[model samples]
Target: MTPHRPSQHARRLVAALLAGSGLALGGCHADRIVNEAYPTTYQQRHPIVLSEGAARLDLPVGGGAGGLTERQRQDIRAFAADWRKNGRGPVGMMIPDAAAGVHSSPAIRNTLAAAGVPSTQIVSRRYPVDGPETAVVKLGYVKLKANVPHPCGLWPEDLGHGGGDYYGASQNREYWNFGCATQANLAAQVADPEDLARPRAQSPVYAARRQTVIEKHRDGEDTTTNYRQEDVEVSEVGGK
Candidate 1:
């Protein structure tokens, strides 16, 4: 018995099916090409990172016979307060040898002590200086800081179309440098770096006010307090 051969119509149908499959595969490949991505959000791309850094203050000393000036004392006090709040380790003092005659380490130490810093927390090291009159005492302490690790203004990928960075150019999204400045500024403006990671604890509710509100609610009265205000007409500056 001769083997039954597929008819022309059946062969054509098989060809059509194979062509459809090829087109589907081509479509999948195209999708893969387009779906390549960099970080979609600026927060992911340029995140604010918390790290240990030195919070430093430079105090310029004038060769005077008197002790620390009022301004200098205030600066030391403020620095001491900041250290008390956020400092991780001892406060370091880079005392210049040139200013030794005018502004001694002992005087600065006393000032720091008066500002509530313990003598043990204040560490001093003498550094050689060329200019005695223009010497500056550098005070610093380790503190937690929030900042963006990646430096801005980098053109790692070409902005214009064409080249190896075709995917970035093709997508109508923000570039690598976009929103970087905003992120950096936000990090700088943050009073406490830790707040970026977690929200602060809620403050205690006012007991008296809460009691008043509860009583008002219980008595079916208005819970909100009303304040007297002067009557005013609506703005008619631009209306007929």
Candidate 2:
């Protein structure tokens, strides 16, 4: 039988690996006479880190007394509810000093207290207001955020076609560290890296639903829900 020849893919992979390892050194950069230039195509990926940071909700000045209107009250209630639900650290109130101590700070505090955020858990601080702009009270607390270390797009070394990374370009494969910034940006965009890493704890079960299911099970009836749906108009089902 004739001697079998290595396939094209095998030949290319070997050439690329050899190019990756220099002919002179046998690892990275060694002197070699091989012309194995393929399109460089590999991308580098970065990891995301989760850290604790302050979360702030800006409350703009309203027309009502204390600088809050009915709409503002509703919004503050929602904010307080969120803080009560997810706060892992004490909440802080940052009042602007330009507005004579937020005319309605007391009432706002009361609303927050009623929404499960107790008085003891709240801290107050005052800062100088900017210009004559309406004062804004910033409600903030500690929350988890996704962060990427170091900014992207740093190319100190030359990526030429004659030596070093040039060899990578000759091979059809991607450069050693290509597309790293894209990966880093994607990691940074994650809203909750901790949530992505692990699932949240399940909330308490619905007592009413559980009881209804139990009763149905005892009576030998189906406990599964069958929601009603509107019938689609037959005329629009198909074109004439």
Best by lDDT: 1
Clashing pairs in 1: none
Model 1 residue runs over 4 Å out of place are 1-37, 62-65, 99-103, 131-134, 161-165, 231-240
**In terms of TM-score, how similar is model 2 to the real structure?**
0.55
Cα lDDT tens digits for candidate 2, 38-105? 32332223345677777777776546766677787887788877676666788899877765446657
TM-score winner among the candidates? 1
Instruction: Give per-residue lDDT, candidate 2, residue 162.
Output: 60
Local lDDT at 177 for model 1 = 85
TM-score between model 1 and native: 0.78
lDDT of 1 by residue, 1-240 (tens): 999999999999999999999999988887766564577788988999999999998877763345467777788899999999999999999988774533556777888898889999988887888886657888999999999999978767777657556666666767788889999999999988999999999999999999999999999999998976678567879886
Root-mean-square deviation of each candidate, in angstroms? Answer: 5.0, 10.6
Per-prediction TM-score: 0.78, 0.55
